[model samples]
Target: MARQPVARQTVARQVVASPVLVGRDEFLALAGRRLEDAATGRGHLLFVAGEAGIGKTRLVTSISRRAERLEFAVLRAAAFPGDAEATGGVLLDLAGDLRRAADAGWRDVGHALSARLRDPLAAQGDPHRQRRLLVQDLADLLCDLDPGRLLLVVLEDLHWADQLSLEVIGRVAVRLPGRATLMIGAYRSDELFPRTAMRQVRGRLLSQRVAEEIRLPRLTAAQTATLAGAVLGRRPTGSEVAAIHGRSDGIPLHVEELLAASGVPDTLADAVLVRARALDPGVRDIAAAAAVIGRSFDFDLLTAVAQDAPETVDRCLRELQSVYLVQAGADAATFDFRHALIRDALYADIALPRRRQLHERVARVAVERGYRDEFVSAHFDEAHLPGPAYWHALLAAREAAAASSHREALPLYRRAVRNLPDGSSPDFHATLLAALGAEAAAVDENAAAAEAYEEA
Candidate 1:
């Protein structure tokens, strides 16, 4: 994409001297104007998209620092691959920033917001409303707190941002114009894929004219030299600059990593996988893992089954929360996939072998954690572990019978009988058959009950 012309005297020239900022003058100047517009109540969303190591983070830092000079309230956070879907991950960071910043704007907004954020969301039957309220609270607070006082919200690594967080940004962007609230987001363009949350939110915002995008290209030769010189604190020889530029390919992060090693060559690395078509690699992985656990999942169980860190599990839940693909359950610790179809979509993507492995993992973890016998038995069955499935099914059947749930006991008893291992003693088999016979008779399945009694 063609970048706008760099201003004659770039705002970047006034930025703190740093090698990364050398050829970044054009972007800084463009960002500078946007910041000015925001400060003057022409608030809106501005996205900076580029490859990893392309200086997005540095650019965000520079923009945030400049916003601070404009007396704007600045909130900054970065999303990681695994933690992008968390409902509260990014906001938690933002609120923490506010508290640490001790900004007067935050004081006016009150601690209630932060406390509420830390506390579990109240059980809401309407997750759509819950999500809207989530975005609205944060958006309205910044937009309405003090219109005269500008606010800057910087979210970096948005390529990995969760749906809820992106939703918040989109909602905030809608309220930015004439509100002195500028939301600056940086993301790895290389990471965005078709149907990804970033792509969808970004496209919609641009289409709505509530957001603009700046796509950063690698540094030019001369600009690369300038950065090399700045890092060396002296004029770099022509050969030296050319070598650095050649080795790093003008990617800012690569340049820094190489330069930091002094004369020795240093290697830099960047890698990630993405989506069920559009899902962020991290979000998609978590989704696939969550799907294997079943339609409904609790945070603790998901963590165990997903094998992702707890925070990542939470963030991904929020991402699914954003798309209405899933809904938080009656309590903070649980949520349900919005529908079986969506779960099936996620589930189908899992290869059969891995699917079985995941089912086994979920079953074992659920069993250890004292989940309902039925839940454990079903997972074990899906995992093809008939022994445990039968054991759990029997346990469930007995529990059902004790609770006077004869109909439920009938099914569970059948499951256990069908799963009996070939080596079980005849007497043992007959005992289960007799019990099944009695339960079937109690439920008035006359022929089936008589058949079971005859077998016993």
Candidate 2:
């Protein structure tokens, strides 16, 4: 048999830079121009897709922002995961004015289809008729609303959208031509499967020559570094930037989360686990023990946590390093997990009860190392011993609030509440509830705050 040569992998070049929009200029310009053309009554429907963290939402936001500057009327709606079967969700979001217009009998089609639009179930028995009715009604509504201004409709997370929502989008897209409208939809291409309703809807629109697609690729290493600079307010060291890029794989959300972390973070733990599962049993054990110790630990500490002989731990470390899972840190005595996500994956793989025991052991080690109250509290909380965790959780919540990290404060407040024994500290419990409500309100989770206040 003839031997086939292995193709070499392409390595991305590292480019140092000051802060800039990393990898989306061309796409943004194209979208901006399309919206401008729509202002001239040349409507267009553009589809953007990528993986979850690939910056689809950011791109949509950027285009919408630019459209607003150009005097375009932009309307936005996002489909929720649980509402994947919701009918008219996006339509209702964009057509709030339609209800009033229908009530006033401003247009014949709007008045005729108002009942169907309001009650999706009423028209469910006849999908073909309902689709037609909606298509005409929407076209008429847009025509009536036209006041020599472009209308930009943005639908995000289309993979989570229901069948009727997708159909309505497709129908609207087909009718958008020669009208002052531009429709843009963003979906997670990775999550969308063949033969699914969303795919069918997209296919139908594309076949009609009514929609075009733009797929967002992962950022290059240089682009990743540029993004990091924007977050850090200064350029990161080359190695630090490379570490982030390696871990994030150029995913925007992953990069941002890693930048936001005050310590080694496990933001991408679930994604990293897919690759971490390849480790051998012994090496995996060493990795898990090292994770419990911390993201960075000395060889002696690893040996202590793993309870393995120095030589055995050495062998496992060498094996792990060979797989690019761990690397020598500041010196030979110490090493670091290649990414916090890898540590998280290894730690998460441990069974729950054993995990709690490991967390307890970690808490003891943290105490010996003179770690901060919050660090120790987290371990104790994980160990299912909430006594020590309660007071520390409140202290941590105060620290987070003082820093104006209100989103971060909410979890600490939640932890404080969860660890408190019912009726044992009624006054303290009320205080925690009040703090929780305040933090929740600051984060725009008003409903959650209302519920918390109601409970209090």
Candidate 3:
């Protein structure tokens, strides 16, 4: 399930009204032309990708207003967390928009869409078969919005859409038949990680030329200053622009928030926190545990450290993925946060005692899996388990030296020396010093090599 949408709004209320669109003249013009083409029976799917707060919504809104002015029936909906047929009900929502329009063709199209999508239990057979039937039903209804008539369907926050919704939407995008309907979706570009469902679909669309996506980058420094000036109703001073630009990192939403509050507003983490807190308790707890493992983690390690069944962890992770908090990584077995900011926020939100416990668990699991000694050593050290920490430090140093990474080995060797467990044998200490001396010499630090030899 996707997260609950804020509230459904009419197309006019949802996107007809937007503030100035900065840094998008060329795309806006291109979209204007696309609208003309769409109205004339050549229609296609379009997409917008950007980081959160980078003005994706604003860009879509600008296009939606133009689409409306050209007599295109504008319909807007967002994918959110909940049962698709219950809370979100995006298909039904669109149907409602159609009914409100009350045109003969549109009203019939709306009724057909509602009949197929509004019920989760009625006439339920094979889920796969039902989904196929729904796709066919949706495709058949497209002509009602085509040829002499047109519709612009704007779907936002697609990064939060569930798998079933994604599949249905993709099929709809593909089967439009170059008629008079344009389907445009907005998703966080950061959500497009390797092997993730969204990434796979996006890649397929682009590769097959089934859709065209516009990626919106952060505002340039000059553009950021311009935006600040507009919000301020006067030109911002050099220092004011610099401060806002630096802190906002050129994300338009951050810029708007900074200008609105005239300060940093305490923490942008608030938004992350609010979303995290709204998650199911079990999922939220797992997210915190994942954070303890850092911004990037694999499914196996997370499952082991999370102490849950693999299927359970996968379910929770899917929920996390749908919300754009964590994304699938280079392969299906790996995952990472959409941004370091998200990971840092979750990590900081964990209590210190719980954090230590998770670190200890992570170290234990890593050791069982024979993970890199440096990784194991860091976690053990964080858990304050000096005995194990010292042991892995020595192992890490030896491994680094074997890999011919003497510079990295030096610190590992020093860490081992500093954290040596009590009651160590004299010969053991001497051997450690000799190994350190060799690595130090390998790096051409003759002075340090002599000091280690003398210690030995």
Q: How many collisions per candidate? A: 5, 0, 4
List runs of model 2 lying over 4 Å from the truth. Answer: 1-20, 96-115, 120-131, 263-266, 269-456
Best by TM-score: 1
The superposed Cα distance between candidate 2 and the true structure at residue 195, in angstroms, equals 3.8
Q: For candidate 2, which ten residues in a row score worst on lDDT?
A: 9-18
lDDT of 2 by residue, 256-338 (tens): 65664444344566444433455556766777778776666779766766667787788878866765568886456888776
By TM-score: ranked, best first: 1, 3, 2
The list of candidate 3 runs beyond 4 A from truth reads: 1-19, 82-88, 119-128, 193-196, 264-456
Task: Report the C-alpha lDDT of model 3 over 321-405, residue by residue, as the tens digit.
Answer: 7666788863568787765566888999998898999999999999999876777887887787889989998887775564344
Q: Can you give the TM-score per candidate against the true fold?
A: 0.54, 0.51, 0.53
Better of 2 and 3 by lDDT: 3
Query: In model 1, which range of ten residues has the least summed lDDT?
Result: 7-16
In candidate 3, list every pair of residues with a backbone clash: 2-80, 2-81, 3-80, 3-81
lDDT of each: 0.69, 0.69, 0.72
Best-matching candidate per lDDT: 3
